[model samples]
Target: MPGPDDVSIRNLTQSPVPYKVLAFYKFADLDDCETLRPELAQFCCGRKIRGTFILAPEGINGTVAGTPDAIDALLDYLYGGAFGTRLAGAEAKVSWSETMPFLRMKVRIKPEIVTLRAPEANPARQVGTYVEPEDWNALIGAGDVTLIDTRNDYEAAIGTFEGAIDPQTKNFTEFKDYVATHLDPAKQKKVAMFCTGGIRCEKASSYLLAQGFEEVFHLKGGILKYLEVTPEAESRFNGECFVFDERVAVTHGLAQGEARLCRACRNPMPSTRACGAIG
Candidate 1:
């Protein structure tokens, strides 16, 4: 079986695909976001790469799309010369698209890489334990553990781990209130959290810890990593995983699922024909 890196490389070289989307995030103290923005913009523009990259003191988070060679070169520079040291074990979720998804390349500095708007929820200081994808099934399946899906309502509606609590939160900021009322940390001893790419849950788990939750755990790389490794037959996840890109959703093995985003509501629809502008 091909590993995640193998799959990413295969997607890039398999065909004459026009664009490949790379989504990734890293949590580390970065103080030179202002200086880094212009350098990144120049490199990407010179290579004809188009996408948005957000830099912050916390770290970097963004999605970029470009030709196979350009993408590889960009990643090389990011992991090597740009950061001064390697990103260690950073991995990106790679997907293919026929047309360019972004109009232009931009690098902007932000306060937080993934905004939760909770000052107390600091992943830099302390966060939940990292649960590997292989061990995720057993951990969440345990009877005593409380599984919480940290994604937005629409993202959870498409798919999530079986029996996981859907907070039905409209946005990440609402998660603080949802946990305050819906969950009791005293009763829920072991809380397992997960999001699309693990970024949201990083802060969510931290919030839970601040709220006095003793045993807070989060998926190491989120649902994307789980689907990439777990076989369809043995998968614990149900339905398609919603993504923030043109492909919309993906199933087990990272294959594009049968779902499209409604232009009006931005909700996942079974087909374009079903998108009737329903909010």
Candidate 2:
């Protein structure tokens, strides 16, 4: 969970957890992505913030972890217009961790922040309606809705919403192919999609809308937001949500799950057994 909104109470020394990890993304035009890249890297480096950032012409997407004070400074630097243009409407899913999730920091500019490799999937132009976490169940429960998990196959293997369709694609680029071959807008008119942190779903929803889907809805802030707000008793998530970091996965309430990545195969397993043993 995020630190107190009041900056004065955000002192790192007083917090129970020393590190605050933030998964954030925003879709906006960034004409100066290249120039802002090195500058952003330097700022994060100076603040000791460590995470991978994808800066692109479309927008910014990344996860960073640091002390509360440092994180506050980083957010202030980002939204405070130090980069001339504010990352307007950029919000993050925050959670406390005792350890840093990444080994080092990186800021690289790419063609698209969350690439579906389809120009039509531009969130800057349009995207599906945002469904709040609390209202997600009702939306998906509707008989006319088709919920698709837009995360990669590996991610879906560990956990996903019950009854949601898994496209089983190895990578994001394959999503376009899956849609073209397996899905039809005229048949599944009302579709909903979700991803780890809402970025992929945003792009996917945009693509679906462009493909003539009658209605598209995406989980606002994605699974992380849903887990944060939904209690375990009411949760539709069956297993741990796989994350792209040392944490591997997180459960309801965003707590670190018991599952760990196997040392050999790097697959998530509930036990500490070797890959073969688990397999």
Candidate 3:
């Protein structure tokens, strides 16, 4: 069997593909997220879409899957602002599967979309420079660069860049403590961080910049985009990338991997950390 890293685009296409899985986020001021929530949920339900969405004053974040036409319709509704607030700059990372990844649809209004808890860490204000997938390897490979993984502890256990530092945070709210205690601005100047998708790192990069970090960079479109675009031969990511869905994980080709959810944590664990080992 070819290893996970050996995945090629050949295996990426699903037979009779019927669902389009979209992962997207945007940091903007949405004064009416409360008003928009119900209508958005109703629209998704009407379109037979399934997944979760977090709408906040800061912006929106979610990963939902539906048929191609349905997905496009949802995008149109969002960008067109049928709910009265347009997400014109929303960027989506798309993939296809044979079935809907989520069992139901949910749209909730929250205080912060991704929840870093620091009011100053506003992605709408500033963020790190974007390092394209093609150029990521060179940037992180440089000795002066400090590569960091902004995801929680379990996500990093499944996969990460070769030299990245895991903050070991069990939840995103703990990230502020990790940054204040573990990082040094004067010593680690050129920082590059990433997450499962772009949301966490989008806010994280903004936080680091607010803390006086000299230079910060983030993976554009996050890991999914990297796996989708970077050929395996040129890819630096190792193991399967955990995803928030029934598929559990995906590999270098953006093809689903052999991961399953741990009932205790309700999070995807690698096959090596199967049910017997999960706690």
Q: Number of backbone collisions per candidate, in order?
A: 0, 0, 0
lDDT per residue as tens, model 3, 121-175: 9888898898888999999999999899999888888889999999899999999
How much is 267 displaced in model 1, in angstroms? 1.9
Q: Which residue window of length 10 is worst by lDDT in model 3?
A: 1-10
lDDT per residue as tens, model 2, 1-279? 222232432442344778888787788778798788888899899989999989888888999998877877787677654454447567576777878988999998999898778998888788899999999989888898888999888788778998899999989999999999988987997899988989998899899989998699999988998998899998888888888888889988888887788777677776544556444
Give the least accurate 10-residue stretch of model 1, judged by summed lDDT. 1-10
Give one digit per residue, the lDDT tens place, for model 1 in 179-273. 87888867888999999888888888888999999899999878988998888888889988998767788888777788888778979876535
How displaced is residue 200 in candidate 1, in Å? 0.9
Ranking by TM-score: 2, 3, 1
Model 2, total clashes: 0
Native-referenced Cα lDDT, model 2: 0.83
Off by over 4 Å in 3: 1-15, 83-85, 273-279
TM-score of each: 0.89, 0.91, 0.91
Pairs of residues clashing in candidate 3: none
In candidate 3, residue 56 scores what lDDT?
Answer: 89
lDDT of 3: 0.83
Flag clash pairs in model 2. none
